[model samples]
Target: MIAKEFTNYIFKNNIIRFGEFRLKSGRLSPYFFNFGAFNSASKLSSLGEFYASTIIEKKIDFDVIFGPAYKGIPIALSTALSLNKKDYPDVPFSFNRKEIKQYGEGGQIIGSKIKGKRVLAVDDVLTSGKTIRNTKEIIESEGGILYAFLVALDREEKGLNTELSALEEAARECNVKIYSVANISNIIEYLNENYDKNHKFNKSVREYIEIHGSKK
Candidate 1:
């Protein structure tokens, strides 16, 4: 159970909160995952270990790890470091700049070159899959193939079309495998079995999922 452990870790750290929150899609959600809560060094290292473990467990093959600009930068770096320490050495990581550098090594990408490489994009969560699509475009534009995507959690909610979950849609549309360390289903199961079953937040989360969860 790495997934269970991760679920507990996120709950203990308050990285995943149960309450009313508005999403970018303008939907009211009962639960929210704040990846930015991993602010401390130890927390970030643990987060990286979770991602690295998932990548290793899944046997994902890639030449480089690419994190999208901003939030994904540290995730990519940390995962690479954790992998190296866990004996998956020399896994190069790269990230894009929000603004292209006009001088010197002038490009949007920083760190390892992605040209002709197989890239694994790392991010926090899968909501609408817009971020994943954008990252795929960036990798393709730079002559790299996006091998797969890894995220901390998969919301498992309906996509824009209200048919498939965002994760499922992203994988199908991008033609790449997408993996998560844990997902909303895992969280629900963990709460029902390990946490207080009578908790109001637990009830609320379960109800919300019943309404919003994807069909498959």
Candidate 2:
């Protein structure tokens, strides 16, 4: 899948970049996607629309959209708003707080009744799956049934062995299906088709990905 809209958005906004950088994972990465740049209302709205489109395309059925907190909060809120705009209204969206508060909403979950609902965890990326697992525990504590996870990108690299991606592990542990709008492979393919390998960062990214991205 080309994911033209998503790719174009990333490209135009400089949200995803080609570079020599160290990731939080301590790996030298060739490309980086900083979803944090979607700070303005317009950008947030646009991002939500893309996410909503992906949800619709994937035919995801769930009662609640749960963002994992911080980053996930805007993603869930924007996606919910976008879905609302498209007239695909579904009530109940919530997100976790980094620090579990003892007051106000109480505990970690905020924004909706989590119990007894089929929840979809939403986030920008699935790196180690730790965040999702923590969110799942929070929701499940309230009797929420987390049956699916949706993300923007899947790196498609191994966590421990090359046999499993973090998304795959999250799905297995959550006992739900998982999906993403795009993956590392998709980005690689897109770059290969759009620009020459001799281009500044293109060849290096392709080579790095080919070495570390596959499910070895």
Candidate 3:
């Protein structure tokens, strides 16, 4: 379900934009995953189900599902909702605010509290991982233990001054495990097999990977 529907949604909605695009890391990337593309309720429901299934399949043992501020908020919430529908039901979910509320119910983390609990951090992608690293720190400060991080996809590009991709390096740095639904290599293989040899999209993707891919 995730394989076909997810891919179809991405391509159909042009969420997977391809071209010479500049990443936040200042490296030129051939493709970018725009999570903002999941604009509809149906799209988010599909995404929520995908995330839920991935967590269940990976068997990520944890107590809390934490999402970082802004973009990560919905993913964490929706995932919790989806998980509630499945075997792992009523999982506590949480997210941080970029700016803490100054009044009434003032706090950073919302939804599930993260004290003396093992957390599974969720996000869309692992780019630089600065935000994620900060998220882990916040969790730890709040007395929660973060042992695993999950994302929708992994680009597999090198992190800052490291041979490992952002996802791998983040996992190692935080001493936690990392999981993803798909990676660049997986996407490349899928494109190569599903698309024509002369497809411009796949060609650009291959070229980009050859240039920017992490050695590891």
Best lDDT among the predictions, by candidate number: 1
Show the colliding residue pairs in model 2.
Answer: none
Q: Point out where model 2 deviates above 4 Å.
A: none
RMSD of each: 1.2, 1.8, 1.8
For residue 102, give model 3's deviation from the true position in Å: 2.4
lDDT of each: 0.90, 0.80, 0.82
**lDDT of each residue in 1-216, candidate 3, tens digit only:** 454555656777777887778878898887899899888888788788988888887788999899888778889888888898886767888888888788999977888899999999888877787766888888998899987888887888887698888877887888888888767776786678788757988988888777777887
| lDDT (Cα) of model 2 | 0.80
lDDT of 3 at 182: 68
User: What TM-score does candidate 2 reach?
Assistant: 0.91
Q: Model 1, stretches more than 4 Å misplaced? A: 195-198
Which residue pairs come into collision in candidate 3?
none
Write model 2 residue lDDT over 1-216, tens digit each, in one string: 426668777778988888887765677888888887787989989888888898888899999999886788888998998898889976579987788798865787788878999998888876767777887788888899987888888877656554677777777777888888887777767787889979867888777766666463
Displacement of residue 10 (Cα, Å) in model 1 is 0.5
Which tens-of-lDDT digit does each residue in 1-216 have in candidate 1?
878889989988999987799998788998899887999999999989999999998898999999998889999999999999998868999999988899998999999999999999999988889999999999999999999999899899998676899888889889998998999988998789866867888888888888888999
Window of ten residues with lowest summed lDDT in model 1: 189-198
